[model samples]
Target: MPDLPSGAVTFLFTDIEGSTRLVKQLRDRYAEVLAEHQRLLRAAFAAHGGHEVDTQGDSFFVAFASARDALLAAVEGQVALLSHPWPEGVQIKVRMGLHTGQAVATGGRYTGLAVHRAARIGAAGHGGQILVSQAAQTLLEDEEEDLHVFLRDLGEQRLKDLDRPVRL
Candidate 1:
């Protein structure tokens, strides 16, 4: 495990919407949709040069070398999932968040406020929406046309366990 550079790294967090309810309702059917969702996300992330850091049930934590790639991957993932048909009684909506900041890398994993902030931002987004931190927004500010298609600013939010509010 090596320490990360002092500069900035991008983190992306995503979660499946209504996953618990859908699991309860679909029972056996949930497995199929979940598998498909995983496949799509993995492919899109790999294609966009994003590295998968961790996964917990229906949620994913990934890292990218740049904010642009992370945001693009998130947007593409949502679009891909939206275009797919789900199994009967199953819905596959996802909420994603991206943030760029200094982080520590150890044991092949990333840690620090940036990762936590990304998770919080993802939680703040609605299903099918992509939310980004102020740091990420700043990076994409000049690429309005490229960003307008998927990312949206939900404004500043006070995240749990953090002192100050983070813009998303």
Candidate 2:
């Protein structure tokens, strides 16, 4: 992986909700559903110009050139999942977090406080919720209303492995 050029970039982290329980309950059936979910998420990310950087189980890490694109992708992903039917007793919801900041990309991987912050924010969000950092929020403030998405400020939250609280 090559190093990412120095500049501001937006990071988006998403994870499926209740995945552990679903997998435990559905067994082989859960695997099939998860595969379909990944396909849908991948398409949504690509459609919004998001770069799929990494995937760990049901969690996806993506990078975008702009905050707007990240937000749109998150919303679109949720909408797409909502429209799909799931196996009985299986509910698929996604939690997403977005942050904008400078990061170092190397070996086709991204690292830095930005990525950590984004992950923290994602953890703070409830299933089916999209949480954006203050920087991301500022970028989307003007357009959020027009986009018909409601963004509730979550103030500051202390995240694991981070020194300071991240605003979402």
TM-score winner: 2
Every model's TM-score: 0.91, 0.93
| lDDT by candidate, in order shown | 0.83, 0.86
Badly placed stretches (over 4 Å) of model 2 are: 1-6
Clash pairs detected, candidate 1? none
* lDDT by residue (tens digit), candidate 1, 1-168: 233333588888999988999888888878887889999998888888888888999999988888888878887898889888876555688998888988888777887888888888888888888888999888888886866654566677898888899987
Candidate 2, pairs of clashing residues: 1-107, 1-108, 4-105
Q: Judged by lDDT, which candidate is best?
A: 2
